[model samples]
Target: MNMPVLTSLRRRFAALAVLIASLPGAADAQADPAATFTALRAVDQRMATIAYRLTTANAPLCRGLVPVPGWAVHSLGQYDPAMRDQARTSFGFEAPIAVEAVVAGAPAARAGVVANDSILAVNGQPLRGAPGAKADSNARDAAQAVIARQPAAAALRVELVRGGARRTVAIAAPAGCPGSFEVLLGPGMDASADGSIVQIAVRFFERYTDDQVAVVVAHELAHNILRHRARLDAAKVSRGLLAEVGRNGRLFRQTETEADLLGMHLLRNAGYDPQLAVAFWRDHGGDVDGGLFRSRTHPSSKARAQAIADEIARIPAGSPRPYLPPLLATRDTPLQ
Candidate 1:
């Protein structure tokens, strides 16, 4: 995507965060910094867990892959300046970045990398945090890029500070589907995947069970796995007012249908119940019929549930890992 378009999407993500802070009880949470941080971590941890399962389980089906350390990092600089001090105290952010959450039984957990360990460097290269936080990601992105460059099977040496003691650990970063999963702190019940990132609103965590939320995550991940954004860009599809009309609308709907179908397989591969896709759509689809989830560029909720149910019925019993659906063949084909 072009810089301008990417910037616009990022702005939307930031807006979601602001919207969350304005909701009921949000003010009270913000008043208590510790409570706010705790709640944020809970949401982030859930997203990390779900993303790890889906990405690692279906890595073979992805066109682009990256080493997943089974842990997520956060920078104190990413928080608002008003909350920076509290964040530093809460998370022990001794460096620019720190391990925010680690998936149990994953590479990072196996390596003894725990949450609150401040990451000083990766592979001997220092990571400097940005000053005057307005949610900058330079340090976080740089660290991830360095790790992604490592050999698929090699261990990643990380320098971190734990309990004020600096130590290094070698994490056997395993390959997984590309893109980072993030929780957008907001009340909006929305989710989206830009070619390189999958973001779900915090409301999903607040309202739905992890299994139901996983249904949405799998759908977004499928979009990235199929390169839907890039394909739409390649086809020169209009993303503005024209996006919901004519050929642009048809193409967008096609991608959504593809994601919905493949998403069922992804859910199954990740050991999640594919039936939740139908349940989730039936329960909350009407609530999201406006805004980004408008029917113009997406099929109706009833149609989506039926299609998912149909696809689930088609999958053979006891399908193997990384189930290859027929739709995978068209992922690389130029969009119409």
Candidate 2:
């Protein structure tokens, strides 16, 4: 979870429009088009699963704040013809927003909303009012707009199609977390938190397995939980060369350490293997360039992996308990 200091150094030269960037392909010849589409579908399926697990498991910690439904969907148009056909063949219907995955025990899950369900309407309202021009945003915004408008602890009437049958299901929204998870377009296995939302890059989904992806995600989610970005600003940590020297370095390392520990618990609570944290760092830590062996900004990969392992050992056996983040010590506008 200790990001390379070199990446930080590079950003010092430019305006820090983005908060954090952490380090972390082959085409088949003449294969069945469906086979290729299946791989993409599998990736999306994993994203949905992890997003739901993390959001719902951490819901209680963010309770009293409004929370979005613990589920993910995508526009049918996002897929190409072959992929669309593959989806129709696999899920029975592909129209409007298609349910990719539903978190176990979340409001959507409790209402019997399962994967492959084509969402037709929300509260009897047709899927409309996409806020953005992009196809993906159009689909996502439409669904979120409905959820965002609901009163606290209000129920949602979702009409969807399963096995070619139309049905209406009622979901009671949890009074949980405030932010939602988003998958961003781009390359690299990077992710970030701006105190409000967790953005995972598409390349990450294309790069790591679901378990590995979960570890990285848990790390970013931990940032939001700890409200690290906001805290750093409140402390007025310098962002220039002074920060690179030691001022901001110390603060960042401190937050990174906290994020790693809380991230493991987040993973465990979400039913993921917290041990993967150790394994992931051990496997990829050396791949990153430019951090001191005993750097003030970040623990060396070896030390970090050890720290993660030690924390994992400290956890007692049983169901993982939620780790509630303290309310903001000082509220500030979230940075991008």
Candidate 3:
């Protein structure tokens, strides 16, 4: 009996060592601050691009989907001077909005807008000021403000420079949801949706590919679309910490399953392989709880992986519907 106990103890210690190594800090050494910020911003840019693509692609299939100008723009040097200099050199012009990407079949693409085109002005208002990061932000804000004020299918004039040649083109805006996304610089695999905004962690972004990131973003967006956050707050499930934890855990586990389903639809609509969702969750799900134990707040990694597989099978490839299942929440158990 004593010998058996000693062997079991040794195996348990080894397992703990593996688990400890996988934790955020132990797994990867601390990253340089500048490098981390740069990486986060890249994720921010990509998320903005993907979110716009997914929402716009599915707009016609879903109701109340408003489309904005279908283009991706970004500014540089928000935190560091080196980034700004890099942007100027990369684009060969110091413009406020750098057209990083244009969605195919979108208004901008139809207008022959190409990547590396530096946006000079919108609606005849010459965009010029400080080339600082704030100026870059202001430029984007002005563009969005202009878009917000326009009617659906309205034509807007955009002045841009390609290969140092100035040209003005007209782009018609589409209707899409007013929701947007941002990235948070932090450790750990965390994401959330609060009605209108989807926040993704940089650590998570660094760990996954764009397709994997899409699954997470789509899931969070699903939460917002289903109004889970507001419903949870309204339920007032519990005031005590332990009580809230138990109630929320149970509720979120259910919502997690639903998000996995809806996220697949979003991914399909956006032209990303829905199968990647299954791969991502399966590979990383086990890491969530370390070993065999699964939390109430989320289904077991095995269960989640299987759920994604099931969902993928249910939704036919190349035919996606922007339909979300009705989420009916009881008084105590919120859908989220």
Off by over 4 Å in 1: 1-31, 291-293
Tell me the spans in candidate 3 whose CA falls farther than 4 Å from its real position.
1-49, 60-64, 80-87, 91-95, 103-106, 120-142, 161-166, 172-174, 183-187, 202-206, 237-244, 271-273, 287-296, 309-336
What Cα-based lDDT does every candidate model obtain? 0.77, 0.62, 0.59
Given candidate 2, what's the lDDT at residue 242?
Answer: 65
Let me know the TM-score candidate 1 reaches against the reference structure: 0.90
Number of clashes in model 1? 0
Clashing pairs in 2: none
Best candidate (score: lDDT)? 1
**lDDT tens digits by residue: candidate 2, 1-336:** 222221212112121122112211114412443443344445555666686677667776553365456676666544433345554665445456777667667778888888789888877777743222222245555566666666657787888987678999888866555565655543344467777667666566655678888887887777886778777888787665565466578777777777777777788777787788888777765443233433355556777788888887776665446644332232233322
Residues 27-72 of candidate 1: C-alpha lDDT, one tens digit per residue: 5564565766666666677888998899888888886577888988
Q: What is the overall TM-score of model 2 with all chains considered together?
A: 0.67
Which ranking of candidates, highest TM-score first?
1, 2, 3
The candidate that wins on TM-score is 1
Clash total of candidate 3: 6
RMSD of every prediction: 3.3, 7.7, 11.0
lDDT of 1 at 139: 66
